[model samples]
Each structure stands twice: as structure tokens, then as C-alpha cells.
Target: MLQHPKYIVRRLQPADAPSFYAAVRESVDELTYWMPWCSKDYSLSDAEAWMQSTSDMWAAGAEFPLGIFDATTGEVLGGTGVNHINRAYRIGNIGYWVSSKRTGQGIARFAAHESAVLGFGELGLTRLEIVVLTHNRASQRVAETVGAKLECEARNRLYFQGSPHSAFVYSLVPEDVR
Candidate 1:
């Protein structure tokens, strides 16, 4: 795991599942407003399964799943990943969330910025996109902080938590990176 003063963002391990489960449990209620999946019951079993798939994807060069950790306490804060990768198009998508307690401390912004640098510089991707719920202004601000632009909105983009929701598409091209 990489250590920063405020947080650590690194590749996830199966061992982190317990903490991940606990973090999600604590944050579920607050997260459910804009993040649809947080309403469901979160168990270690599901976390383990998700970690297994994340490990496999990392092994296959198809994904990079990262867990954010608190630096001083070494607690798992939350998870994020690069998904929907298209090698031919030289593009990928960034998805992320922070634990409730850590929300306003810029952990998600640091993680997202690091991920974007990796995606563009290391992975040689030309474009990176983020799809966030329209109501998620905090996340939107993070995107803008990283220099991502507001693209088109995906109308009725997701059937989330039993309701149709629109998503704001944001993107960063290679030129947008430092």
C-alpha cells in the first residue's frame, strides 16, 4: 500500500474484506441516497467473492481495484476501481466511493487523481470517464477537481435501488492530465 499523510490507496486483498464489510455497513445508510447499491445487506461472504473477482481481474490485466486506507490507523476506508476498459479505444471508467467518516477529507480526490495518473501515464489510456448520479455533487466536485469535464448526461442511465436515475458523464482526456 502507498502511504500518504491522510490516506493510502492500494490494490485490494482478500484480507481486507472484513474491514470493507464493516465500513460499508457503517456507511450504507448515508451512501444509499446517491449510491444505489449501499441499501443492500453487506456480508463478508459477498465481500470475499468480490475480492476474488477483483484479484482475478487484476491478474488478467483487465481491472485495477484499489482500497483506500487510513494512514495512521490503517483502516480500510472504501474501494474504487477502473472498469469498462476498452483497449482498442484506449479508454476506461473510474468508479469510487469513500467511507462516511472520511468523506470530506479529500481521500477520494487523492485516490481518483492517482488513479487518473496511473490510467493515463502508466496504462497508456487516452481517455478516462466517470459516471456519477446527478445528485452526487460531492463526487462531481471531485471529478472537477481532477480537471474532468462535464460531458453529456446519460438519461435513465441506471435502474438503481428500484428507481430510474440519470447520470452525469464526466471525462478526462490525456491533455487534461498533469
Candidate 2:
């Protein structure tokens, strides 16, 4: 777990289903624009299933799904994690989303930075990548703030919702964080 003055970042748990559901519901409209999995009909069952999958992935050492929470009140702020793990290659993908109410507060960047530290220091990953839609300036800014370099742009590199979207790929190494 990573603690900050404003928020705490930690692994997802089964007990977080309700709060997670609520947060996602509140942010659904904004999230749907960038997150393929988000939609108007997202339900509590989906949140529960996602939490379960996260636990399973963690146990299998395949992915690390984390939650960002308010430090004092413990309200769910958003989600961030090092996923798409490639253990043999020592690489992982970083992804994050903040509740619309929480955007512009640097929460995504801070949580992403902490996720990178965990990826490099605890997970022994050598490289972490953050792929942002070409139109997603906010996410690109977060990547830059976390010291990820723009490596390239790939055609239809991301599969969102159902269709493929091109993205600007950014990467970071341990030295970049240090």
C-alpha cells in the first residue's frame, strides 16, 4: 500500500464493491469517453466481478489492480494499477482513472507514480508503459508528470469498448523514477 497526505493507494478487495460501484456510476459519463469497459448500465455485479478478477490476478501474479482512496475519510477516489503484466519480459502497463469530481487534483498522477514504484521496486519490473489515446491530453499530461517518455504512436494499439484506437505510447524505467 502507498500512502499520501491526500489519499491512499492499495490493492482492491472484495469489500470494496459497493464503494467502487458508486464511484464508477458517478463517473460513468466521463469514463465512457476513455474507458471502453465503462457504460451507463454498469452494475454492482460488474464491480464485484471485477474485484474478484483482481484478487485472482494478484494471486496468480498476473496483474495488480489498485484503488485510490481519500486518506482521512477513506472515500474511493479512483482506480490505478500496473496491469497487462509480462513477467518474462519484466514489463507491465499502467492504467488509471479518477472520478470526475477528483480530476485536476493530481490524484491520477500521484497514484500512477506510486504504482510505478511498486512495479519497479516490489514487482521487479524493468519497464512500465502508459498508453494514452491520441486525443487524451489529460492522460498524456499525467504520463509526462510521472516521467514517462513518449516512445511512439501505434496504429490501433488499444482495443477500447469494442473498436480499436490508436495511442501514443509512453514508457518509464526505474532510473526515470529515481
Candidate 3:
């Protein structure tokens, strides 16, 4: 588990299902726009399945999806991860999202930076990428705030919700952090 001054970043547990579902449900409108898997029809069963998938991925060292929680109250805040790993190249993707009500509170920025630290320090990744859909200004800002250099705008970099998207690709190296 990783700790921040006001939050904790850790692996999901079975008990987190209820809170996870609530978080997703509360942010479904915003989340569905970018995260295709989360739709208006998202249910508690979906959260359970997601946790199971994340557990399997963690065991395989394929992807690491962690939940961010309030340090004091243990409330589910959001999620961040070092996923889409290319182990041979020591490269991975760092991504994060926060509750809509918590946006503009620097939570996403912390999650972004911490995830990069996890990528470099724990995952031993030499390079990390933050790919934000071109239209996602808030996420782009978080990537920039964490010192992930804007590399380029890549066409068709992501296929989500059954469509191709142009994305702003950012890169972060170990030196990018203190």
C-alpha cells in the first residue's frame, strides 16, 4: 500500500465492492464519457467482477490497478494504476480518476504523481506514459501538473466505446519526479 498525507493507494479488496459501486454510480456520468466499461447500467456485480479481474491481473504482473482512499475516513476517492505494462521495455501506462465531487481538489494530481512513483520505484518501469484523450482537458492538466512531458498528439492512439480517439501522449521518466 502507498500512503499520502490525506489518502491511501492500495489494492482493491472484496469488502470494497459496495463503496466502489457507490463511487462509480455517483460518477457514472463523468466516468462513462471516458471509461467505456462504466455505463449507466453499471451495477454492483460489475464492481465485483472488476475487482476479480484486477486481482488476476495483479497476480500475473500484467497490470496494477489500485484504489485511492481517504486516509482519515477510508472513503473511496478514486483509482490510479500502472497498467498496460511492457515488462521487457520497462515501460507502462499511468492513469487515474477521482470522484466528480472531488475534482479540482488536487486528488487527481496526487494520484497521477504517486502512480508514476509506483511505476518507477515499485514496478521498476523506466518510462511511463499518460495518454489522455485530446478532449479531456482536466486529465491533460493532471498529467502536466505531474511533469509528464507532452510528447505529441497521436491519432487513433486509443479505441474506446467502439470508436477511435486522438490522444495527447505524455511521457514521464524516473527523473521527472523529485
Candidate 4:
């Protein structure tokens, strides 16, 4: 677990499903535009399945999907992960989102930076990427605030909502964080 003064970042557990469900339901409207998995039809069962899948992937060393939570109350604040790993090159992609109610509160930024620390310090990653949709200015800000350098706007870098979209690709190396 990664402890922060404002929050904690840790692997998801089955017991977290209820909070995850509530968070997703609250944020689905905002999340739907950027996250393909979140929708009006999202259910608690989906959250449970997500927790399970994340756990399975972690066990397999395939991915690390984690939760951002309140340090005092354990309420779900957001989610972040180090995914799309290149183990041979020690690189990974960092993705994150905050609950709608917590937008503009720096939770996403905090969770993202801590996730980078996790990637570099424990996951042994030398490089991490923050790929955000070109239109997502909020996410872009989070990447920049976390000290990731804007490498370029790559063409067709992401597929979202059944279409290809260009993305701002940011690079975060060990030095970028420390």
C-alpha cells in the first residue's frame, strides 16, 4: 500500500466492490466520455468482476490496477493503474480517474504520482507513459503536474468510443519523479 497524507493507493479487494460501485455510479456521466467500461448500465456486479479481474491480473504479473481511497474513512476516491507493461524494457502506462464529486481536488494528480512512484520504486519500471486523449485537458494537466514531459501528440494513439483518437503521450522516467 502507498500512503499519502490525503489518501492511500492500494490493490483492490473484493470488499471494496460496494464502494467501487458507488463511485462508478456517481461518476459514470463524466467517465463515460473517456472510459469505455463505465456506462449508465454499469452495475455492482461489474465492479465486483473488475476487482476480481484486477486481482487475477496482479497474481499473473500482467497488470496492476489499484484504488485510491480516503486515508481516514477508506472511501473510494478514484482509481489508477500501471498497465500495458513492457517488462523487458521496464516500461508501463499509467491511467487514472477521480470520482466526480472529487474533481478539481487534486486526487487524480496525487494518485497518478504515487502510481508512478510504485512503478519506479517497486515495479522496477524505468519509464512510464501517461497517454491522454488530446481533448482531455484535465487529464493532460494531471500528467503535466505529475512531472511527465509531453513527448508528442501521437496519431491514432488510442481507440475510444469505437473510433481512433489522437493522444498526447507523456513520458515519466525515474528522474522525472525523483
Q: For each candidate, what is the lDDT? A: 0.83, 0.92, 0.89, 0.93
What CA RMSD would you report for each candidate? 1.9, 1.1, 1.1, 0.9
**TM accuracy, model 4:** 0.97
Model 1 spans with C-alpha error above 4 angstroms: 33-39
> Candidate 4's residue-wise lDDT over 31-51, tens digit each?
888898888899999999999
Q: Each prediction's TM-score against the native?
A: 0.89, 0.96, 0.96, 0.97
Model 4 / residue 42 / CA error / Å = 0.5
Better of 1 and 3 by lDDT: 3
Q: Can you list the residue pairs that collide in candidate 2?
A: 36-161
Candidate 2: 10-residue stretch with minimal lDDT: 31-40
lDDT of 1: 0.83
Error of 1 at 103 (Å): 0.9
Candidate 2 residue lDDT tens string, 81-164: 999988889999999999988899999999999899999999999999999999999999999999999999999999876788
List, residue by residue over 22-56, the lDDT tens digit for candidate 1: 88888887767656555657677877887898899
Q: How many collisions between residues are there in candidate 1?
A: 0
Instruction: Encode model 3's per-residue lDDT on 76-175: one tens digit a residue.
Output: 8899999999989999999898988888988888888888888999899999999999988999999999999999999999997788889999999999
Order the candidates by lDDT, highest first.
Answer: 4, 2, 3, 1
**Residue 43 lDDT in model 4?**
97
Error of 3 at 139 (Å): 0.4
TM-score of 1: 0.89
In candidate 2, which residue ranges exceed 4 Å CA deviation?
Answer: none
TM-score of 2: 0.96
Model 2 lDDT vs. the true structure? 0.92
Q: How far is candidate 4 from the true structure (C-alpha RMSD, Å)?
A: 0.9
Scored by TM-score, the top model is 4
